[model samples]
Target: MVDADQTFVIVGGGLAGAKAAETLRAEGFSGRVILICDERDHPYERPPLSKGYLLGKEQRESVFVHEPAWYAQNDIELHLGQTVVAIDRAAKTVHYGDDGTHVRYDKLLLATGAEPRRLDIPGTDLAGVHHLRRLAHAERLKNVLTHLGRDNGHLVVAGAGWIGLEVAAAAREYGAEVTVVEPSPTPLHGVLGPELGQLFAELHREHGVRFHFGARLTEIVGQDGMVLAARTDDGEEHPCHDVLAAIGAAPRVALAESAGLELADRALGGGIVVDEHLRTSDPDIHAAGDVAAFPHELFGTRMRVEHWANALNGGPAAARSMLGRDVVYDRVPYFFSDQYDLGMEYSGWAPPGSYDQVVIRGDAGKREFIAFWVKEGRVLAGMNVNVWDVTDPIQRLIRTRAQVDTEALADPHVPLADLLP
Candidate 1:
């Protein structure tokens, strides 16, 4: 257990950071707990930013991880709108902005989340061009969407990932003409493979969302400081009133990099390297959330996951490790997404392009199916799309790593629980 007098500092006020602070308090650490956030708002969740909140189905207050009163009640100090400029590892302190405010910590947790990758092309600074990562960004996008609905505007989304697709669905729902441009042959091809990707493509197409597959964004054109059109490398220009560059996000590793922490391999996207216990090279400092690349004993590889579940669970694991508890942080990685009429739940780890075969149960055409990625008859990963109440069984199959006949696995008549040993 940590000493009662040593302060524990948490950087980044997103879900992970907030959970870490909660864990520290729950673990009976009576010392000071300081959570530094760059945003003025209290710590909040991000998934709602692109879904319910953006669609007007949820209110602003629902997005926060905790009500403001909870922090004060828990005796957790919150330093909002503050940027940590540098980490003085030797002095065990973090320097804030130019004003010279600093905080000392006996144990520090870095949950610095990722930021959306900005488009480098021309006209990206136009008024109608946006990237959604923070609540402020979503608020701006929602306002633009509201006006676009009245004007019968067109929106061009430059990417086909989860954010891009979900935004496309929401935009379509808002009565905007929507077009999605993707460099890949199919949307979500890298993670869900082409078959499932095609299902998503079909789903969007049926909803009047146009697509430009195998097309790369060349430039965004603007008129009077507002987006008017988007040009692709395929020589096609899509006229639009708004553009969302949902290409991807890069981990915010500036603090870890500046502190001279060991980074993972460049091939693995270069996040702060951590051991099984989530401790970085410097034992006093630990990394979690999107910025941590830790070894996965199940997959026999080091990976960094940017999904919500990873951050949700990893925070407490890192806190346990900080308090000198025996923890491995080996839980099977899980993530879920909601797009259009489909709800998906995926579990276990199967790096892109590693699975040998994909076996499907139920009808893919009916949009209700569970797809499992197997390698040499051993289940590696599984995803249930539009299917409910099977995540536990799917994860159990992955955890056991049992060999099974593909025919029995694909037969919906056979119970998933019956296959488990």
Candidate 2:
């Protein structure tokens, strides 16, 4: 049995940290659990921020991980609106809050998460500039969308990544004119890769969302502290009321970095290094969620995943590891996104050039299809667009790494289960 006197400190207020605390208590560890959140609100799931909540489809309360009373009822100490300034690794303590109160930790979990990568351009400080990462930002954006719709305003979104596209879809659904600026030739170039980028580009374009491919927002021009237009490097000025900077996010590693924890290289997306068990350089210290760069034995790579699924599973896995349980955090990478009428679920990692072939099953034009990234006759990744009930088979194929016949893979008649080893 675990010592009741031991205290575990979790420095984050997201799904991962909250779920970790819940797991710790459920596992019968009657120890002190301290959850420190930089945000004033209770721990919440982030997926709804960009999708349902931003579209006003979900209530504000729906985004939260648990009810406000759940923490108190479970004897979990929640330090809301508090920041951990530094960590004394030698002393095994964390200095937090403005007063720098030191809290001793028997085991520490760093789930600091990631921050939105802001635009470093003129007029980004304008009143109409928006970035969606937090609940507050989504609330503000929701109001902005409502106001824009009522006034027939135009929203110029920089980058065609998941956030940008999702918000663009929301803006369009709200009756606002939308234009997306992306440096790549197609939307989601970095993620979907070249094979399926055009599919998304066309999907957005079909919904009246204009695409400015092969371009990037160079500057945001405004008058009287409000956005007027966005200038792209391709010598085009798009007149708009607001600019949404959905470029990307940077992993929050300051706390772990200051504590001298080993971090992954910038090339690997730069996160605090954790072994298969989610243990950092210090065995007692663990990291999960967007802040952790963990090795995957299946993929034979170290990666940091910034998605809802990662936090949902990573937290519980880390909690078990913290309890000295045998664990190998090698679950296949997965993520999902909803935009307009299309819902997509992606499994596994297949970066550009990693897969030799891109196979499509079913109708791409109808947007109900499964696209698989296959290399060496084995599936590396699969994306189901507007398709459901096949995630298990898709993940199984990726997990088993079984060599699949191309003819059967592209055939809708063949059941995915038959492809499994």
Candidate 3:
């Protein structure tokens, strides 16, 4: 058990930071824990911001990870609206703001997370152009959607990743004419393979979503401080009322780098380097969640996975490691995205061409299917669209590394449960 007087400072109060603090208390740490958040509001779950929250299906309070009373009852000190500008590694302390208030820590955890990558195109600063990253961003987007009077205006979402698609789906549900622009030949080409991405492209196209594949956005045209249109490199100008950039995110590691902690080149994954224990170069300081770039057991390479599951699992793993527990933080990374009428569940690791054989289960025509990514008779990864129950058994098969009969596995009538050990 940790002494009540001991100080533990957690930087960045997102899902990762909040979960880490909760796990520490649950693990018998009764120390003085301080959660420092640059935002005024407490920690909240971000996944819904693109789907339910933006669609007004969920209340703002409902999105918060925990209520204010829970923190008070747990004796967790939440320092909201406070920024930790620098880390004083020599004194084992962290400095905040221009006034320079400093606090010493016995152990520190950095879960600074990531920020939305902005478009470098001209007219990006226009009033109608937006980038969703924080609660404030979502709130502003909500206001914009409300102002546009749902279903009447056009919303141009740049990028084809999960973030872009989810927002496009939300805007569509609000009755807005939604168009998704991507430089890639297929949407989600980075996450899902080209075959699967093409399938998704067909899915969206059927639902009235215009796809601008291989089209590069050259400029964001605006008038009177409001975005008016997006001009492509091909010189095709598409009129839009509001523009949202969902290109992806970058790690917020300024504090870590300024503290003299070693950093990997941004060209190489661009995340804070950490060992299996999630410890940085400094023994007292650690990193976790999206900002953490650690070694992957399956690929035998260093990479950073920015997903909701990483934030949920990595934070506690780092906290447990900090508490002197022997733990090797390795789990088959899993994530999901809700876009339009599709609910996608994915598991395991997939490097480019990681799977030599693709065994598809269920019927894609029915709009409920599972695609199994296999290599050397081993399940490398799988994606289930609008079929959550099927992935449960596939996940089990992936976890156990069971040899599946390719013929039997592909049989839709056989059911995924029969393929599991």
Candidate 4:
């Protein structure tokens, strides 16, 4: 049991940060826990923003992770709208500009999430352009969609990843004309490969969403400080009232870097570097969530995944390590995205060029299916759309490294449980 009044400082107010605070209390660490969140509003559910929230189906109040009363009951000091500008590692303190307050942590957990990548092209600073990383961004986009009434207004969504597609789906549901522009030969080609990319592109195109493939965005054309159109490398101009840049996200490592801590090996690629226990070079300070680059147990590679599940699970793992408990942060990477009427779930580490065969289940035309990515007659990774049960058994196989027959996987009638060894 911890002392009744021990001070612990946590940076960032996203899922990872919030979970760390809750877990500490639940673990009997009844201390003075301070949560530093830059956003003015309290921590809320982010995934819903692009789906139900934008559709006006889910209320803002419903999305709050914990109630204000819960925070009070747990004795949590939530410093909303406060930013931790710098970390004085030598002094073991975090300096904040809000009230010139310095927080000293016995062990600090950096869950300082990520920010949406913005286009540096011309007219990007226009009034109608936005990136959906925070609740405020979603709220503003929602207001615009509501005001515009969908029919006359046009929305140009750059990138064809989960975020871009979800945003496009929401806009189309509202009756707005939506056009998705991707420079890749196929949508999500960089991540899902061309075949899976074609499946995703087809899903969107079938929903009345226009596609601009193999087209590079040269500039965002605008006038009087408002976006008007997006010009492509092929010299084709596409008109739009609003633009959503969902290209990708970058880790918030400025504070970590400034403290002279060893940053991740993302100088050329992406993510912050961390050991198996999720600790940075400076053992006193630990990093987790989307910002930290964690080493994979099975794949034997360093990677960074920006997913909600990982953020929730990684924060406490890092915190435990900070408290001197040795734990290896290893789990099959999993993520899900909801677009239109699809609930897509993907599980396991999809190392580049690891899978040699794909066992597809159900009909793609019906949009209800599961696709098993197999390597050497073993299930390496699995994706399900409208099929939640597939993830459970596949996750089990991944956890145990179970070998299975590829023919069983390809057979639609064969249950996932039967393939488990």
lDDT (tens digit, per residue) of candidate 1 on 1-421: 4787898889999998999999988988889999999999999999999999999999999999999999999999999999988899999998886698998989999999899988888888888888999999999989888877778999999999999999999888888889999999999877888877898999999988999999988899887898879999989999999999999888898889889999887666778899999999999999999889999878888888888898899999998888899989878889888887889999987756788988999999998999999899989999998999999999999988898888989999999988888
Query: After superposition, which runs of candidate 1 have C-alpha atoms over 4 Å from their true positions?
Result: none
lDDT leader: 2
Candidate 4 lDDT over 173-289, as tens digits, reads: 777888888988887776666767788888888888999988867799899999889988889899999899989889898888888877767753455678999888887778888
Task: Compute the lDDT of residue 27 as modeled in candidate 4.
Answer: 71
Model 2 C-alpha lDDT per residue in residues 1-421, reported as the tens digit of each score: 4698898999999999999999998888799999999999999999999899999899999999999999999999999999999989888898899998989999999999999999888788899999999999999999999989889999999989999999999999998999999999988888879879999888888899999888888899988899999999879999999999999999999889888999899877999999999999999899999999999878888999999999999999999999888989988989999998999999999988788999999999999999999999999999999989899999999999899999999999999999899
How do the residues 136-169 of candidate 3 rate in per-residue lDDT, one tens digit apiece?
9999988777766554888888998988888877
TM-score of each: 0.98, 0.99, 0.95, 0.95
lDDT of each: 0.90, 0.93, 0.85, 0.81
Which candidate, 1 or 2, would have the higher TM-score against the true structure? 2
Clashing pairs in 2: none
Clashing pairs in 4: 264-273, 272-293
Off by over 4 Å in 3: 149-151, 390-392, 415-421
Of 2 and 3, the candidate ranking higher by lDDT = 2
* The best candidate in terms of TM-score: 2
| Candidate 1 vs candidate 2, lDDT winner | 2
Clashes of 4: 2
